[model samples]
Target: MNRWVKALRAPFFTASAVPVFLGTAVAYNHTGRISVPDLILTLIGVIALHAGTNLANDYFDHLSGNDDLNPHPTPFSGGSRVIQDGLISPKGVLIYSLSWFTLGCLIGLYLNWRRPGNVILYLGLIGVFSGFFYT
Candidate 1:
């Protein structure tokens, strides 16, 4: 309803929790241990990453002038209102994008250290690049 609430992208945020559920399921299926508590941390971390990325995408798209266009809705745009509806500023989007991407990188670094094979290096690097390259 509101711009701020819309910006959070709650559905996207919830999707982050999918990783925790998936991880726990895999661990249980393989190790026979379903540790809900541990998964809570996983969920939190993942949620952060997802939220960060979503925010980053929103922010970057707005900054790049892509959101300001009046083109037909496509897969990427999905008809976002920031640009078309003039819901927010480009600078505002950049600030939000930088914030979320930074958060994602921070969490990703932590994850890499905590779990070496986290593929965090790959995920983080690509993710950061995507933020810019998705121009």
Candidate 2:
């Protein structure tokens, strides 16, 4: 579990989570109500996206020798050294990343079905595209 957390860069999930919380707060403030289910789903979707992005970054960085060339990798600076450190295989990382992306997209689709717009679909597409190519 510890290795998995390190591979997922779980500490950095706040970068994804804070915005979701703020969005929920804003919606509640405006409507005077909150749907707990939506909140939970949104959180899971965003975090999964975040985790997928992080893993994809690590995989691509390893592929391009970016992480390999880094001489001074810190917890915040360089990509997680899971591959380099042998905590997780590069193929495994890529698979996990894709799995997370799929899960996020599924949740996004569900949320879109609940709502009455294609906004979630558009956003999810943009996120997945950017994340996959962000290396």
Candidate 3:
């Protein structure tokens, strides 16, 4: 469990979660109402996207020898050292990253179904594309 958390870089989820929270707050303020389920789904989707992005980055960094070359790596920089430290295999990282990306897209699809437009679909596609290719 601890290894998974480190591999997922769970601590950095705040960077993705904070925006969802602020967006929900703003929507509630404007509408005077909130859909808790949608909010929850949004949070989950965003976090999954974030986790997928982090894992993808780490895997690509490993492939590029970036993480391997780093002399010192902290929790906040140089990517997670799970692969370098042998805590998680590179293949495991890629599989987990793809799985997270799939989960995020599924949640986004559900959220889009609840909404009136295809906005979420487009956003999700863009996110996945950019994140996967970000390197």
Candidate 4:
């Protein structure tokens, strides 16, 4: 349970929820009401995307030789435990990350394809860019 929690990077969870809340707020902001279903799906997608990013960051950093650096850095250098501390494996994290990311992307694409305007596309692109730079 603890390991799973760490893989999720609990601290970042709240930020993940923001999109759902924001999307709902947008729904309401213009019409004085929100779409509950949209809110729910947004939350789900957020969870998958954020969790996947966390795992990928862990896996890639490990691959980049930053994970093995002894004594740990000032949090400025790469390599965070999720794996280094034996909490998980690089392969396990990689697999989970890819799976979740794919799920999230599919969901996002589905939702946006139904006429999500530009918000969804912008956010999705931002996420992919973030994942690329995060390592």
Candidate 5:
């Protein structure tokens, strides 16, 4: 449980959430309305994307020996130490990352269907592609 939580990088969920809450607040201010379902879905999708990206990066960094070779690493700057600390394997991280990414895409598809703007789909595609290609 602890390992999973660490792998999720719960602290960094804020990175995924702040923009969402900000946008929600702005929309509520401007339109005087809020769609609770959309807000909840958006938060889940964003957080999943962040978690997947982090896990993928950790897997790739471990594969490339970058994490192992880092002489000095800060908690915030270095990759999560889940793999380094033997909490999980690189393969497990990659699998879990892909799972989260898939889950996020599925959620995005649902949101796009519900909203009917295709904006969510496009953004999700862009984010997933960029994250996957990022080293």
Candidate 6:
């Protein structure tokens, strides 16, 4: 696989998107309506958030010496081995994570502007903070 692809951990994006899909479905089933643009924006924002979280985890784990000591790390236990394996630099990972996070925030701001509500802003802020501090 490509180093960039591995760094993004594309497979894990579904975990973030599933909630958005389920929520949209419930809303549609209840109201018999849906906003396609909103749905698309939500999905994009969520995927970016998830990617940022994963990158942050990889960067922090490497920084804290955890990944270095995990001799028999599994896919779920240890962080992605991209950094430890020299596939990408720690600085690169951090920058990538920050960029995704910024993108997610920008999407959230756009959603708030379109919908006129604080819910999106609050949720996005919480998700960003938690994801960045999870490790």
Candidate 2: the clashing residue pairs are: none
Stretch of 10 with least lDDT, candidate 6: 72-81
List the candidate numbers ranked by lDDT, top first. 2, 3, 6, 5, 4, 1
Worst ten in a row by lDDT for model 5:
69-78
Instruction: Please give the lDDT score for candidate 6.
Output: 0.90
Query: TM-scores for all candidates?
Result: 0.67, 0.96, 0.95, 0.79, 0.92, 0.95
Off by over 4 Å in 3: none
Each candidate structure's count of clashing pairs: 0, 0, 0, 0, 0, 0
- Give residue 15's error in model 5 in angstroms: 1.0
Per-residue alpha-carbon lDDT of candidate 4 for residues 1-135, written as tens digits (9 for 90 to 100): 587666766567788787678767777888997667767777887788877887787888788766676465534344447788787888888887888888888878877887748778787879866863577
Highest lDDT: which candidate?
A: 2
Worst ten in a row by lDDT for model 1: 75-84
Off by over 4 Å in 4: 70-80, 116-119
Tell me how many residue pairs clash in candidate 4: 0
Better of 1 and 4 by TM-score: 4
* Candidate 1 structure quality by residue, lDDT tens digits, 1-135: 887556666665655676668767888899998656556645665665555566666666655566556367553453345544667665665566567666667766766787758686787787577644454
Of 5 and 6, the candidate ranking higher by TM-score: 6
TM-score of 1: 0.67
lDDT score for residue 67 of model 3: 85
Which digits, one per residue and each the tens of the lDDT, describe model 2 over residues 2-118? 767888889899999999999989999999999998999999999999999999999999999999999999987679898999999999999999999999999999999999989
**Once superposed on the true structure, which residue ranges of model 5 sit more than 4 Å away at CA?**
none
For residues 24-130, could you state the per-residue lDDT of candidate 5 as single tens digits?
Answer: 99999999999998899889988898889988888888888888888787767668889999999889999999999998888999988988578888888999987
**Model 3: per-residue Cα lDDT at residue 83:** 89
**Regions of candidate 2 where Cα sits further than 4 Å from its true position:** none
lDDT of 5 at 58: 89
Residue 110's lDDT within candidate 6 is 95
What TM-score quantifies how close candidate 3 is to the native fold?
Answer: 0.95
